[model samples]
Target: MFYQAKSTCLYCDHKFTTTKVRMSKTKVLKRDSDFCIHYDGPNPLFYDITICPECGFAFYNSYRKLSDHQRKKLKEAYISKINVMNMVGERTIEEAIHTFKLALLTASIVNERKFITANLSLKLAWLYRMIEDEAEELRFLQNALDDYIYMMAYEDIEQEEVDEDRLIYLIADLNLRLGHYVDARRLFSQLITGKQVSPRYKSLAIDRWQDYKEELEDGD
Candidate 1:
């Protein structure tokens, strides 16, 4: 259910092979509200980040080629310090987490966009959730929430091709998961009432809000 794919490292231009799950062979079991997908076979999420053994640069398919400054900074701050491990083979959950952490570090070093950071944090949170590590999951969820908020406040959603309503919904859902009920309710309301928002997100917001209220009432 896995195949090796050849990839060129963005930082050092090193050609290497990385393992990937054959999506055609995998079956979707369920998808969480947070968009964590459960697959019947090997999870493709685990193989999303590719680490180059030559320079220790970790990245995903969406990552762009680095500038000279970023390359220099990475060499001084990241590549020179850590011993690059050969992670080209099939990755375990622990190995995937390790690669994701490295990618997060590299993303920070180059000042990668907020959306990308948010996505990486969210995936890390999902990975932690898979291991039943609630503390780490919440921590990364908080990180993702913060990054998403920053993106909305300062970044250009249109240019980034990000759906604004979807981002808002995610922020709201993350707030709910993190127990920020007041903020979650407010955001859910925003999505529900915004005229420009898509009906899909609006319906989703209403469903989540209603379910939350029902849970509260049931508990009481």
Candidate 2:
């Protein structure tokens, strides 16, 4: 009987040892030839001995591979559900930020509808601002703004429509939050001049715009 060594099955997490009985292929006279091995009894799940970096299992799927298609779709679905959650609740903020980022990544991969793309971009920007990723926050907000503006003016319409004004201020608010004062001030001023945003938010945006400009000038 051949001696067996115990090891963790990296693929499925089954703990076991190789059976004592084994068969090995004859080594080819040629050196460096591919070696073939045969085993008896329950075949240990292929389970690579090498560890999986992302998942921490020797053969288990990496996070990327585990999430490849279905997990991403699930993330998108979760994000879709949390879209209606307001900002005030205990779990709301966490859920919003998580789903928003997931949606942004998934939307980029899936070629979803324009609003999903637009809204995810907007939500991701806001989430980044909340977490203090200022540069990333502005970059995403600008992207959302571009997506919304392009969609509102033109871009395969008939699929869906939304409150463009709300989106405009949402983007502006993101900029304000991110300390992109010049950009925020410009957008808020334009929206206020056109009365394009809701009165309440527009007033808030204007106030923020003024504050942002003040900070800018003081800093200068």
Candidate 3:
């Protein structure tokens, strides 16, 4: 179910082939509260980013084009510094992680939106979680939390990307994971009280809030 598809890099206009997974071949094992999917076969998450072999450019759906300034910086920082190697065919988990790391590095160099970086960090966390790498998972989780917080404060999240209810729920969930109990409680409270929040998120927020309170009581 894995195959290669032609991709043209926006940064360098260099055409290349990238591996992709056919979703029909994969069964969904489960999904996390944050909507991270666990698959029974080759995970599609591994093949999300498109990396250009010729210029060492890496990107995904979030970033399709780059400004002149961003292109110049990416060329100097990434294209000029790294040894461009052609990566084709199927990829192992380690190789997939490496590709994601390259994408993260490129996103940083190009000053991509916080939403993009946050999603990348979250994906890294999910990838590490799949391998049971707790340390790396937590590290990327913290990065994702920080980026999401920044996004909430300074960035406008389009409804199509992340609706208001999902955004609040995500913030609450991140705070819960990070042990920011007060923040989690606050956001969860808001989510539960919000009229526009869906029943799914409201129920989740209610359950998590109760769990947090119970944990605090047990600790005391």
Candidate 4:
């Protein structure tokens, strides 16, 4: 989905609020149309692209299927972004964090929005937890869990089973980090029950589960 854009000033690079855009289309009752992605349109389909009124940052909200070439390009883009993230030191950590999130936003649009969103949100949640931002961490962890669920829903088509399982484990880990012991235990239990999940992952889950049990027993 390309739309859902934040406006920006091209000259000053200041971002603004987001606004909705509409699409109009025509359909025939009986016949199939070649122009429609969903085959619901009979003839010409007009679509709206969400655009920034200020800087002309137009994005079309779409769910594009990933091709192998696109995946490779995405990997390259991600690596480059990580390299860029690492370039900043202690002085620029805040800017680095913003850049990292923006890069993740772009990654979310690249055919695997659900997975990217889950991963990004979880990472941010962990970071927030580290900074003692309990409310923010909880919110982001929930976002991560929701996105992970969405990603899991498409596991069959996208070979996302392993990733989904991993995300579950991550969610459990984060929950534990945030002192949500019951939630972490339940999530870890669910993750460990997945026979299709890798042995390594299952082992990790078991280890975490034991640790969690101990923590609960220790009354902290």
Specify the highest-lDDT model's number. 1
Per-residue lDDT of model 3, residues 50-165, tens digit only: 87877777787678489999988987888889877556667778878887899899999888889889989999888999899989988998999999889988887883368768
Who is ahead in lDDT, 2 or 3?
Answer: 3
> TM-score of every model?
0.96, 0.43, 0.90, 0.48
Worst 10 residues of 1 by lDDT: 55-64
Question: 1-220 in candidate 1: lDDT tens per residue?
Answer: 9898999989878887888999899999998887789887799998999999787789977776889999899999998899989998988899999989998999999999998899999999999999999999999999999999999998888988988888899999999999998999899999999898899999999998998899899999
Model 1 residue 41 CA deviation in Å: 1.6
Query: Runs in model 2 with CA error above 4 Å?
Result: 1-102, 155-161, 174-186, 195-198
Query: Which candidate comes out best when scored by TM-score?
Result: 1
lDDT of 2 at 121: 67
**Candidate number that wins on TM-score, 1 or 4:** 1
> What would the C-alpha RMSD of candidate 1 be, to one decimal place?
1.1
In order of TM-score, best first, we have: 1, 3, 4, 2
RMSD of 3: 2.2
The alpha-carbon RMSD values of the candidates against the true structure, listed in the order shown, are 1.1, 22.4, 2.2, 19.3
Backbone clashes in model 4, listed as residue pairs: 1-61, 1-62, 2-59, 2-60, 2-61, 2-62, 3-60, 3-61, 27-42
Candidate 4 similarity to native, TM-score: 0.48
lDDT of each: 0.91, 0.49, 0.84, 0.52
Clashes of 3: 0
Better of 1 and 4 by lDDT: 1
Model 4 stretches with alpha carbons more than 4 Å out: 1-91, 104-112, 155-164, 175-183, 190-196
TM-score of 2: 0.43
